[model samples]
Target: MNSGLNFLQTNVNKDFTTLKKNLKKDFTGLKKIKVALLGDSATQFLNQALRACAYEQGFEFEIYEADYNQVSRQLLDLSSDLYQFAPEFVIVFESTQKLQHKFNSLQKSERLQLSELKTEEVKNYYHTLNRQLKAKLIYFNFSEPMDGQFGNYSNKTSFSFLYQVRKLNLELMNLSQECKNLFILDYQALSAHLGRQMAFDAKMFYGASMNLSIDGLPLVAKNCCDIISAINGKFKKCLILDLDNTMWGGIIGDDGIENIEVGDLGNGKAFSDLQQWARQLKQRGIILAVCSKNDEQTAKEPFLKHPEMVLRLDDIAVFVANWNNKADNIRYIQSILNIGFDAMVFLDDNPFERNLVRTNLPEVEVPELPEDPSMYLEYLSALNLFETASYSEEDELRNKHYQQEAGRVIAQKNFTNEDDFLKSLGMTSKVEPVNKFNLPRVAQLSQRSNQFNLRTVRYTEEDVLQISQSENYFTLTFDLKDKFGDNGLICVVVLKKEVSALFIETWLMSCRVLKRGMENFTLNTIVEVAKKNNFKKIQGEYLATSKNGMVKEHYARLGFSEAGQLWELNIENYQTKKSFIQLN
Candidate 1:
């Protein structure tokens, strides 16, 4: 009887153990940040954070980190390789340590290997090669290729030699550019600044049995924080500044502009630091506006003549150097920019001003300013944010870009015809698919782009990779380069192939490039892709969203017929359809 009882107890415990494990697994599935990783160990690092974060949140992550790290020759080819994982974004991290090493290593190699790369364009060559190698290694998350597809597509291709690596990366960059869903994570900048040996004491995954140390990855938690902050920033715009204590020291009207402590020496150091930092913001794509009650010239002189002043007149997107209520100034700034209330950031030195704005413009983001003025530097720097996947040279010229916009408006005043005004602005639009070179920006767009999204499916860098590799999944990204300079990657088109049919899953564009004919160009590219794949019919589903009503008839205009509520277009019929614009 004792032995029988013992046996029953043992079996019951075994069943309980099974139940616990299964419950944990189910809970993990629910909480895991599902990422389909692409590229090098950098991707692995991001996964580690995600895993940790999931555990802490009482969830588990479903991730696929590619065994190889080289990018695909094209995003179109992604459907053939990594698409099975079904990731949220295609995570691509840059390795700063390897860029110089690879370039130097290549330089010492054979002359034949260096044939394709321009010696003078060493930086460009190295970057291109890095993408190729990383993509090859990262494109395949698992050890093997899908059932029957190419296992080592990067290697099987001709001229994949190390010396000829630049050639491979160039092609991969092109491929990624074509895929709209490819999200490239550039941890390189952080690693480059912080050095490769750097690790963080940042928050890690809690309650996780699978202890993957963050030290295994380079930028770790801090970079992850940056990634999060960046995603949160894109949908935001405008900055409202406080006058008396925030911009400078003491009351501006009482102390006088010269008496205001805003210099490199003495107590003015903090104010100078703030000015310089704020000045740099305009260069890095953030808008700055001020609110103060003082004589306009007095409030403006520090920026004009103070030797220690870091900011310039041009940097101020808008400012109210008057006694008027600050909340009113912020409202005016928002109206002038045509931006929404939620996109604004309010900064005040006084509790009164901050609270007033909070009550009135509740949508505006108001991060609590530190009480001690000495901590302002660290406080503001923490909030600068790592938004968008990448920043190009044009990003530095944000003020100039907007200035040109103002010029366009002013030039319009002198011209009677809209066409003539547009023609005078000398606008030029260059539309291209998302590539490895622009993958970071594309991913940034995926995260931040809200208004023009057909379906706002925000993806991280890793999710983009799985989509890129998804069998028959095609992602198309578009760039707008007009007289306003490059708006960078501004539009995206995600295509999913279900057996013989092509499903237009998600199509979105940035509001910045709206009404500029980018949509037509993107539609044209989709038309061409569907024709090439011989998809039975181009189909799209509209779920009747609040913001996507503008696109309600998108497929219909592209020659699609409505089947009940679903839109379907024949490839043959779409081939002949023409819009008012021409695409290359």
Candidate 2:
């Protein structure tokens, strides 16, 4: 660790000092990415590293620093120099304490106003301090020392401190909805990757040795590299944790489910600790699955019977606990989940098992866990590797949902008619023009949707808002409710007026809501919008893609005439056809 630190400090000084020495003298014409760094000493290092990175990338980075613990200073610093910098990206560090510092200052003001702040407006408030957001991408870094330097203090990574950090997570999640490219880069997530391999003790550096010792500092250069990499490539989707001593201490296959330690006492406590932490990950909506070689029934017994099993079997989306190779199991889980190799994080105590998955599923991320059992908590806690800037409570039940949907598919064989099966779902669809609230989900669906999408026109939250506020265009989303559950915002539609015709700009639905006549109802709504807009005709296109063959003839199904190469639905011709879904 000491050697690693010495090597790291030397690397940082070399990287940063070299960048500063080669600083571009001309700041005028080159595309300037104005960046503001907020917080204390640790944050300064982050800016320096980022500036050097920017320099190496051959870009001019104009940087502004705000006083530590000075929320007023944050406000003041932005108002004066933000516009001057004209930052293409705003990287806010020491941000975990933003709300706390604001509250403390409000206590000082005595008349601090909370109502005056709007979730979206609070972001623009920064613009009032600096310049308008030229580059709308905002990356937030929430990292503090385990020694209780920045965030709340605790001896054993206390619940209170983790709770505050979680709060910061939620705030950024909500905040991200208000802006395009709002990213929360978990500093702790990136640092934990280095573990004991690096050092973060405040006093870890000294002189040329210090120059070589930057890795000892928390949030080292490698940590920066990982975060940038994660942001460049989106976070993984599934966390495939190994059972045996990994999920809980001791192997259930060897020790029997009842005897396997995982409760409030002895080795049980360690398993319980891991189970408890895993539940939080589920809550954030990241899919949790099991990939271990064990007797399937015996392994499941503990989760079902153990009162201390915080990770109930239902909480897990999939389990491939068999005698088969772990890599094969991961492939099986990924098949049903329909996610990318880059989206899965494999957690296993055995280096052999971890390495097997790495070699076979090279895209699957396998983060290192320290060898010592006592190091489990910090090793896992420090490696905050997953990122979900967009999350919801519904994410918690995602696994159970896949199971229920599977059951529904099995039950579908019982129905003689398709409408009977669809009606049995008790499906209800509520469609309205996209407003500020639905803009987030609508934009998210557009960004992620592929298969069921008629036209994959992705838009930002701001872009969605702009379309809605336009007189010539309209955008809207649908809320789907069924006997199973509320599907949340599951569909989107965008329409615009071009020439004297109604043009369907984009139409997409969550694949989860597909087989139900939601498509027909959605098209009916489009025609009504066209009728209301007094268009002579309506037009739409089918951008041929490998996956969208399911809806290739969608315009023809709506009784549109195949005119030339384009699909056209003149209002008079549309009225002649009786293509409409009977909304029950």
Best by lDDT: 2
Model 1, span 72-152: residue lDDT tens: 332224443445454433444433223323445664444345423432233342244334322211221111112122234
Q: Ten residues in a row with the worst lDDT in model 2?
A: 204-213
After TM-score superposition, what is the CA distance of residue 207 in candidate 1 from its true location, in Å?
16
TM-score winner: 2
lDDT of 2 at 441: 70
